[model samples]
Structure formats: C-alpha cells, structure tokens
Target: MGSTEDTTSTTYSDASSSPTQPLLSNPAPTYPYPYPDPPPASEPEPTQFLQISYNYGPRPIKDLPFLLLFSLFALSTFAFGIFSSVNRNPNSSSVSSFSYDSTTASCVKNATTSSTLRSPTFLPLPNSFALHSSSSSLLKSLIWTLVITLIISVPFAFSVLVLLKHYTKQIVYVSLPFFVIVPIFVNVYWFVACTVSSTCDEKFPLAYRILVLVFVFVIIGVIVWIFVVNWHRIELTVRIIGVAADALSRNLGLFGVLPALTLGLFVYFVPIVVFLVLARLNGKIVAREEDGEYYCVWKQDSWVPAYYALAIITMFWSATAMVEAQAYVISGTIARWYFSKDGSSLKRSLRSSLRNAFGPSSGTICLSGLLICVVRFVRAVVDNAREDAPGMVNLILRCCVNALLAAIDFLNKFTINFAAITGEAYCTSAKMTYELLRRNLLSAVFVETVSTRILAGIILVLSAIYAIVVCVILKAASNLGVDSYFIAVMAWVLLIVVLGYFVHVLDNVIDTVYVCYAIDKDKGEVYKQDVHEVYVHLPISRNSRSASALVARTPLVV
Candidate 1:
C-alpha cells in the first residue's frame, strides 16, 4: 500500500511539473504588479475582442514528413499503420507531402505567410478534423462520402425539428446576427444549413440569409406604411435617419448603420483589428535580440490601446449595418407592397421598384469599391492608349488621365490613413532611405510636394525613355519613316512608365520623415548599441550620384 501510494504521488508530481502556457491577462512581464482586472463590460461597453486563455503551445509536431515516413516502417514494430489526431481521419495521401507552384515564389502561393489569420485558408473551416488524412485512399474517400451524406441530411433534420417546435421559431431571429458576428465558431451549423437544410434551401438555402433579408423587407415596409398611413405623421424619424447617415459619411467612408451595405464593411474592419492585436503580440514589435543583447520598446507607444478601441468600433459598426440593412430590405417591401392594407393594388407594382433597390443593395459597399476599381481600370487602359500627337482631343485625354492619376494618388493617401498603421517600408528598404537622406542633406533642400511627385516621375520616365528610345531610335534609323515617329513615341511611353515608377519610389522614401526617424532610432531597437551597423553614404537629390540615377535609369519595368 505504501509503494502504491508513493507511485501515485510521483505520477501526480510529474504531470503537475510540466510547463503550462501563460495567459495574456493584460499585464506585462517586467511589471510584476498583479493584474487588476477591469470592470465587466456589457452592451454600450467599449468593444473588446477577448482572446481565449489557452494557446495550443508551440507546434511540437514539426517535420510531419518524418512521422509519416515512419508510419510506413510499421514492419519494424509491426505497428505500420496510420496516426490520426482526434476528430481527424487517418489517410494515405494525408501522409503525402503537398506542394504547389506559388504566386510570389514562396512556400505558400503568395511567398507570404498569412499576416493576420491563423489558417492558410482565410475562411474558417467547420469540418476539417484530425488535421491529417488517412493512409488508405479508399478509407479517406469513404470518410468524405460519410461527411457529405451527413451534411446533406442534417439541415432537413434541423429545419423540420425547428418548425415543429414553436419556441425554436423566435429563437432563429435572435440567433442570426450572433452567427453573423462569429460564424467562424459555429461553422458546422452553417455548413449543415447550406446542405439539405430545407426546401426553403431551394429558395434560400441559407435560412439565416433569407430570414435576415425578409426581416429587412419587413422593417422598411413598416416605416413606409407608417409614413403613408398617417400621410404626414413622423417627420422626425425620416429626417433623422436620412440626414444622419449622409452627415456621418461625408468623407468617402463606410456607412455601417444601414442594411443596404454591411458585410463587406465587416470584412474591411477585420484586418484593422487583426493588425492591432498582432502588433501587440509580435515579438519584433515587443522586443528584439541583437548581438547577444535584448531590447524592448513596448510601453513606449501610447496608441496601443487605440488599436483595440478602433477594432471595437469596426465590429459594432458592422453589427449595426447588418441589423439596419436587414430592417430596410425586409420592411421596405412590406411597406411598398402592403402598406395601405386597403386596395393598394399599385403597391404590388412597388415590387419592381423595391427589386431595383434590393438588386444591388445587398453588396452596395462592395459594389461601390468595385466601381472605383472599374473606374481605375478604365483609366489605366485609356492612359496607356495612343493619343492624337497634336490635337485638343489629345490635350483633353491627357488632362483626364492626369486628373485620374491625381485622384488615385489622393485615394491611396486616404487609404493609408484609414488602414492599420504600419511601421515597415517596402522596396529598397534602408538603402533607399539612406540615398534619399544623403541627397537631401547634400542638397540642403527639401522636395516640394509637386516637385517631389514630378521629379520622381521624370527620373523614371527618363530612364525608361532612355532604354526604349535607344531601342526605338535604332529601329527608326534602320527604317526611318512615319514608323520613326511612332517608334519615338513608344520610347517615350515606355520611358515614362519605368523611370516614373523609379522616381516615385525615390520620392516616396524622402517623404517618409517618420520612417527615417525610426531608423535613426534603430540602435535603440534592433541592433545593439555595441555592434557596428553597415551604413551606406547615400546621395539624396536630383543632382545626386550615379547610384540613385542608376536606380531610376536602370528600370526595365516599373
């Protein structure tokens, strides 16, 4: 009995001694002051996305290939079989390596890791179990069959079950937006709804989508019905709703209050929230190790909290949009069709009008952005098209193209302001920064916004022109004619595109005083104060050295 008790004690001790993951309970490691939790938050509370207290620890199952290969050696231990995680099936191809040619020459197609999402597939998976497949292809195939079969039958089971239960009918309404907000969690439920859910699936397979849409039509209809029935009763409601929407969205901003547009807005804001959370969590942002030394700059940022707050704003706004948009679509139709309730025969005709509104209303926000892209697309094509060499039409087209270019530049600036704040720069990196600063410091002059834009554009155009012009001039000299003129223009056009982009990069680097400032502070961040950094002396101006001029002139493509 004493030996048995001792064995039990050892086992318990061993289990308890294992390291467990720590929770991010809103306190820093350096500050050992115990975390005083905030008061409970409720509706109208500042929005916050809570993280689950548990992490799956690190990926201990690295080099899955070896384990898979080992499974083939089951002859050694007579254990050659499949290894599967719970909720996952074991399959043959599941052990096989999967690879594909990628978009940007990366391991994953884009040569980029998922910056925000945990999954390679951004859309949440409801039914990917085991995280591994079966060793037997036939077995894997059978599992898929069962999965599909289950998906097909479950929906009907649910709809019929719910229809029979009176209490379940109202529950559907309350449960909808909850699913809307975190559909990722109850993915299996939605997946079931998608398949064999109901005959209503024929009309609207997504019962939630139909219910929401119907609800929208109903709400809008009631508002219209009230307005028409009284003929003049609630001037305040109409004015408040209409004016407030327009006022809040005077800037080219998203409107979250209305149902006509909301889902896309939710998608748009998700990245913003994700970025903030990641920045707070990222090892790079929190601290850095260099030359056997470590540095931290976490609490130095004041806007850290604002990131979370803004994400909350994005979520609440999205939820509001889903609710309000649903109300409009559901109620508007009823008002238009059934408002009078007394021989409103023409009210049936109102369906045509409502249909027109509802047609594009479902994705109006997405549609608006799409339209902008279309406009940008057209502008890109037209600008690249040949122009009359010397005519008013040419001038007009040029002006229009220039205006479009200007608008795009402005829009990009606005986008940056609205987007999650980023601390990194793309393109030439520190080299570009050094060059621009060298030019600036040497010239002892700053680039005016217009000159900056034009100067960069000129360098790129000149470089590209040089390359294309050299090529075209050779062609023209060999067969000089009207073709010569065309060749010259071609040189000029290609020249503009490449050189223009080069200068654009150069100009952009100079403008980012903030980034340069950060770099100067790098000793305090990335590198240790002790280790010498390789610094390049750069020429920063128009009248600069060969390195920068080559940067613009060497462009084969923008």
Candidate 2:
C-alpha cells in the first residue's frame, strides 16, 4: 500500500502542472508514512542572512552646527570684552576720581584703636568684615586656607573613594542613624537649655521658639519619611554604589582624565575672569555726590551691561558644559566597562570614551549644557526677583521656576547617560531613555530621591567636618581675627567643590549603571550577572507581567 501510494504521488508530481497550482498540494497524505507538506511555491524561503555592521567611529555629529555657531559667538564676545578692557585708561579722571583715602584712613584708625568700624560717625563700611580689617592679610589668609584645603581634600577624596568601595553599606547605615540621632539630640539639648537658662528665654522669644520648634519638626519629619521610604532599597543603592566603585577602581585612568578635564576648565576660566575684570574698565567715570561728598564713579558704557550679560551667560554655559562633559566621560567609560567581557579593555574604554565625549558627542553635551544653563539663569533671575520683592506672586514664580529647573536636571541626568552609551542626539536619547525606563518599570524620581539624599548627606557631613578642622587649625596657627571667619568660609567652599567632584563622578557611575541595567531588562538579556542578581530586587510595576517574569528567573551567575 505504501509503495503504490508513493508511486502514484511521484507520477502526479512528475506530470506537467498548471502554473497556477502547486504540484505538492495536499502532499502530506500521499505516503503511508505521513510526510510533511512543502511550503506554498509562491513564498520562497529566505536565503540571505541579515547582516548587522557595527561602526566604531564617525558617529553622526549631533548638534554640530549649533555648537560651532555658539562657539563663534562666544569667541567674538570674549574678544569684545578684552578690547573694551584694554582701551580704557586707568589714569583718566573718570577712573581715578573716586578716592579711598578717607575710608582707608578711618579703617586703619579703627583697627589700631581696636574699635568697631561701624562707629556712628563713620561712613557705612562694606558688609564683609575683611573689608574693615587689613584686606591684604585677609586675602593672604584666604589663599593659604584654600591651599591647605586643596592639600587635605585630595587625600580626603581618595579616602572617601576607598571607604565607599569597601564599606558602602556600613557607612550608609552608620551615617544615616547618626544623621537621625544627632538632630534629635541637638533639638532636645536646645529645648533643655532654653528651659534651664533664663538668658535663652530672653534671647529666644516665644515666636522665635515656636518657629524653631516648627522648623525642627518639619525637618525631622522629612528625614524620617525619607529614611522609612527608602529603607528596603538601601541594599540596592549600596550594590549600585559598589558596582560603580568597582568599575571606577578597575578603570583608574578615569581619575586621571577627570582632573585633566577640571584643569582644562580652570584654564578656560582664566580668560573669562580676566575679561570680567577688564570689562568693568569699559565705562566712563561720572562725578556724583553722595552724603555731601563728591566722588567720580565709573559709569559703564551702554553696551557694557549687555556685554556683561553676555559674558555671564557664556560663563554659565561653559561651566555647565564642563560639568556635563565630565558626566558624559564617566558615563561612557563606565558603560563601556560594564558591557565589556574582560578587564583588558579598561584603558581602551577610557580612551575611547574620552574621544567620544570630546569628539562626536560634544555637541550633544553642549546642547544639554546650554539648556541647563538657561534654566539655571532663569532660576537665578527669579530668585533675585523674589529677594528684591518678596510677595506671593514672586514666591509662586520662583517655585515654578525651581520646579522646572529640577525637572530639567532630572531629565538631563538619564538622557545624557543614554546618549553617552549609544551616542544618540540629545532629544533622541531623551525619548529613548524615557521609553526604556518606562518599559522597565523604573522610577527616575525614586532613584533620584534615594541616591541623591544619601550621597548629599555624606558630602555634607564630610564638608562640615573638614570646615571645622580647618577652622581649628587656623585658630591654632594664626591670629587672623575676623579674617579667620572668611578663611574658614573659603575653605568650606573649596572642600565642597573638591568633594563635590568626587561625588559627581560616583553619581554619574550610578546613573550609567541604571541605564545599562534598564537596557538589559528591556532586551531580556543580562550583561552583568552580578548586577542583575542584585538589581533583581528592584521594585517593578505590579502591572508588568513580563518584568515580573524576568525578575522571577534565577540570575545566571558566572
């Protein structure tokens, strides 16, 4: 039976068939041994495999034209500022008419007599106490203080990195508890002291006491709320930090690159500072009378204010660009390290990342940088308005502007990270990032709140301690008088900048890891198993069945 069936089918298949009909129609029933039917003759099987070629370089230069135009404008404005400064004559009456002799003499007499410069008979002095004392000594003290701060902060930054790497969880736990307890202890101590000391009762009136109590309660509530909400995710945050530290430690070359970028920024600012100082020389000195005294004031040229505005805007843009550039470099480097199969490519990754940051992706950085600068500038404007005119309207405007600034900052964070990884344009990267994060059930706000608060707390504590240490050392070593306060303030600022950069690098690392993890989850692939194992605990949206399933699987550990 099988032989006869096969012979009949073969004979029919061999016969000339109509072009419209397939000869193998219903071929499955032809043999006793069931045979599978062939595919319809109209649809041909694909013979050519789709090839995906990866291009290593020459990425489409995003926002290049805008970048170039802005650069040209910046350079022209800088030149104009320089020319205005150089052409102004210091010996001109307008420039030299304002005499400081009387003020200087009064200050000197007050200093020698050990009396306050604010004697009723004396003209009002500048707000800075340094101005009332020996300005030269104050300047010297500030310079020395900053120098000392830099020396100390470098080592401190390294120590922090080491601590973060080895004892992230311990630090978080200890610091958070201390942070909570210290405030409570201080508030209690204050209340007790106020109750016991009659002087405190007189100094802190009922209204003041009530205000302080309210402020304390509000702050404590906020702290407690943050702590409670993020408690479960603390471990995940630590793991993220640990992974960042590990990646950074492996690619130590980033450390070198960061400082170089900073130095470059400093170098770039030199001319800006010079231009700012010289730009002031562009105005005409006009004679003016105040308090029955005639003094020649330099009235700036009409264009000077506009020029100043331009310079200021340029500075903001440049500063933001430098910061964003650093983020890009860190993100690119860390993302590369995260995806690479081995440590052999560490140096190569850093180099390539650097090239991409400053090369093709630079325009994207500039675009984002400009946006942040504009937002910040507007916020500053609104803040000034609020300060000058404190009203509900100004306050509300300020609040709205602040919220906008924060939103931009939040969006820029991950957008730049995605752009760093894929070399996408700013808008495109932002869209893709939003979709990727949304699809993966990630909350930008939650991650930001948890990670930022923790890191900010660490930096604040370190900076405060550093400031106190510097103050103590200054008090022991020098008789700076009121200048000591100025020095300490400057020292604090320096430490914040130094430590802030350290934190900034780690922050970028965290953002990069977040984006990389999101990519992995979206594609249903694990690029870094250890990270995947830890991140599996990250909270996903309850509605996401696919994400739930993905999380349910046991992470494959190498």
Candidate 3:
C-alpha cells in the first residue's frame, strides 16, 4: 500500500557516470575542521562507516550543553537527598528510635497485605534483629546497607566498563555518571524517609505536600504549554505513524502477523513457564484453600537461588532468540515495503531474513541478552531482598535496578533495529544504532518519545476495551461459575500479551523504516518516498552541526 511510483531509479550518481562504477567509490569532499579527513582509498573508504556513524557521534562541544544540564540536575537531586536527611535527623534522634506512629504503621501493613503479582508490596522491616535501636540491630542494619550498596554498584560498574571499552565519545560516556549518581540519590532519599517516618511512608507534612503539589502543577503547566506550542510537529509525527501503519498492514498480512505474534509470545511466555517449573521444582508454587477458594502462591525456599539462576539463563536464551527472530521478521517486512516488492518477494526474503537473524546474528543478540540477564539478575536480587524485608536498603536497590532496567531496555530497542538493518551482532548493532540516534537526536527523540507514549496509550485503551468484552462474555457463559478474580487476571494478562505483540511489531516497523529513510536520504539517489516530508517538516535545529550532518550526510544503502 505504499507508493509504487518509482520517481527515480536507485542510481548512485549522475547520468554520465559509468554503469560499473560504485556509488561511494570516490571520497566525499572535505568539510571544515572537527569532521575527520577522508580515509585513504586503501582504507576501504570511510564514507560508509561515516554514514553509519553519522547518526552517532557529534563533536564533544555540541554535547556540552546536555552534559552540563544533566550534571547540574543530578547534583541538585543528590544535594536534596542530603538536605532531606539532615532535616529528618537534626540531632540524630532517628538513630536511637526506630519507632513509627500508628498512621505509618497502618500504611505499612496495608501496603504489605494488598501487594500482588503486578506490583511491589511493602514488607515491614526484617525481624531478624530486635526492634530496639540496640547495637546489634544497628550493626545488622549497617551490614545490610553495605550489602545492598555493593549489589547496586555492581551493574553500574559493569556499565561504566562497557562504556569505557566501547564508547569513547564524551556524549556517550558522560551519561553514565548521571546514571551512577541516581542510586546514591535514591539511597539518600530513602534514608531520609525512614529516618523521618520510621516506617518509610513517603508522605510529607501538610505544608511540604502543598508545596510539592504546587511544583508538580507548575511542571505540568509547562508541559502543556510546550505541547500546545508544538502541536503541528506532534501532528506530523502522528501522520508519519499513520503512514507506517499503512505500510505495516500491507506488508504483515494475516499470515505474516500470526508468525510474528507467535514468535513474540512464545519467547515471552516460555520464560514464565520455565520460571514456574523452577518454582514448582523448588516447591515454591504452593496451592492452598482460603474462604472456599483455591489459589496458588509462591513461597521462597532455600532452593530459590537455584530458581533464579536457571531463570536468568533461560531469560538470556529466550530474549536473544526472540529479539533475533523479531528483528528478522520486521526487517524482512520493511524491506519489501521499502523496495516496493511484491508478496512473492516477501516470501522469498522471509527464509533468508530468518537465516540471517538466527544464523549470523545469534552471537550478537546473545551479548545483548547478557546485558538483559544482568538487569534481570539484579532485579531478582532486589525482589528477593525486598521479600526478605522491605526497608530503605531494598527500596533504594529496587529503584536503582528499575532505572538501570529502563536504560537497558531502551538500548536494546535500538540494538535490535541496528542488527536487523546491518545483520551485525548485538553489540556492534547497538553501537551503530546508538550512533544513528546520536546523529539525529532531535528527530529520533521526537519520533520515539511522542510515538511510543501516544501509540502505547492508544493500544492500552483498545486492549482494556477488548479485555472487558472478553471478561463479560466469559463470566456470562460460565453462569459465573469461574472465579471473577481469576477471569480478570487471565483477561488482563492476555490483553497485555496481545497488545504488547502488536506494539512491538509496530515498533520494529517504525524503527526499520526510519533507518531506511535516513540511509536512503543519505544516499540521495533512490526510489523516492511519500513520507520524507513528514521527517523534513519535523523541528530539527537549523544551526546545530548535528542537524546539518543529518541533512548533508549521504544515505547508507544504494
């Protein structure tokens, strides 16, 4: 359903150019300083690499503004943590009295009791030590503090090593420091909350809460103001998504869609099933009856570590395989759309694409999965820690793990896209994908941020409606024989899986198409596109080298 009109041949150069000559055989003319000189002909011509890297590195000077901005914000957050801690313990009274008021005590109780699989429920402080602020309890708390601190530090330290080893640019490396400081800030924040409320209820005093509300309102107002101001750009982004959806619909017909959905669901559910098996093996998933209802619960046992270890291993395998397969399918579908090929061409490409993903790209995505495993392992640690005792240490550790998880997830999205496009391994593709985003920061941010939020919201709304309809039908059909809670849980889980499947499909298409667009635009001579105008009209800064580089850079593919 895309434009079949071939405006221009996929020609690389002028009409007078020899048919045998390659498009990028000659070095591009030199630009001003800071842009590196063209590599010698013997060096395999750096233009292609530059075109790939074009999307990544900008001069350090160009990123100075962002670095300074984030640094100041991180420092401010860190300082605020310290300030709150001091206010909570002006004379060190908190150190002597590990006591809580009734309100805080009830809040903790409710939080612990009402927790479910979908959310983290608070647990009261561990009773391993005495309740009094005795020396033994204090010493145990300090040891817990150090252990949690070390656990949190491990992942960040690994990330730092990764950045140093692979990414030399200031913009790439500088972001790590900000991430590292976040856990410290979180730790301090929790320390302050525990010191003040003793039970870690995050409610501030009435006056402070009012001030916080005012600040939040001001932030919301500013966000609204910005959205209103940039309505046109947002509209254009929506239209671009519409174009992508059209392409997706045509390329991934019922036959293609089912396979993609099956692959994604299999990958996702297999781990859960394996985890369950492991749980059962450890005798953790215990069945019990309460109030005439039968239900199952997970009880951690001594073999819990074994369960986690196996879960991590399976997660790496499943994620690697899933990501590789998804990339192949998505990229294959987009290739057909980009090239305006027939259905038969898609069929032809499918086998080859899958081969590429599972064959050559296995090791690369496995590396990516290793990163995912690390994040998951850390999460498992945090979850176990919290289950043992939900205190300031676990709270801070969970927060830090969540932040790192998000960062890794974001990185993986691009890594998959890069792997799809280049058939490179995970790390190489990640570097390349990051480079592209680095080069086209404005457009990348605009498209990804706006589209993800809007598309997810739309999908979730539809999913909710669908879930409600299915639940009503199921309830009515069974004459309400089934437990309503079980029905609701199944419906929700199914909806999420279904919605997530399509969401990821759309995500891959969007990423692939944009990468194609960037590469095609850089190449300058290709079958023209109807959707380039959408990107053209988006708000990229005119004066910045980053924007100009995107504009002036040649396409990566012929």
Give all TM-scores, in the order shown: 0.19, 0.71, 0.49
Which pairs of residues have clashing backbones in candidate 2?
none
Candidate closer to the true structure by lDDT (higher is better), 2 or 3: 2
Ranking by lDDT: 2, 3, 1
Rate residue 390 of model 1 by lDDT. Answer: 54
Sorted on TM-score, best first, the list reads 2, 3, 1
Candidate 1 C-alpha error for residue 257, in Å: 17
Q: Using lDDT, give the best candidate's number.
A: 2
lDDT of 1: 0.34
- Residues 109-141, candidate 1, lDDT per residue (tens digit)? 123444565656575366544333323433443
The C-alpha local distance difference test score for the whole of candidate 2 amounts to 0.71
Candidate 1: where is the Cα deviation over 4 Å? 1-266, 277-300, 340-558
Which pairs, if any, clash in model 3? 55-435, 55-436, 55-439, 56-435, 364-426, 522-554, 522-555, 523-554, 523-555
* C-alpha lDDT of all candidate models, in order: 0.34, 0.71, 0.51
Model 2 misplacement above 4 A: 1-55, 90-148, 185-203, 210-214, 283-300, 384-404, 463-494, 542-558
Model 2: which ten-residue window has the lowest total lDDT?
18-27
lDDT per residue (tens digit) for residues 1-558 in model 3:
112212122122232233222222344533222224645545554434444312211111222332344334334433433433333323222222222234432111112333346767777678634444454543553354335434543343334223322342332224323332433443455455555773344544546645654665566556556656866665565666665665565554533544665677566655455444434333223344569654444444554465455444554555554554566567655754575533334554555555554555545545555566567777777777877887888788788878888877777876766665556555556666665565465676677777665556444544444445555665665433334434544555555555565656676677777767666655663543566765666555333344334534444221
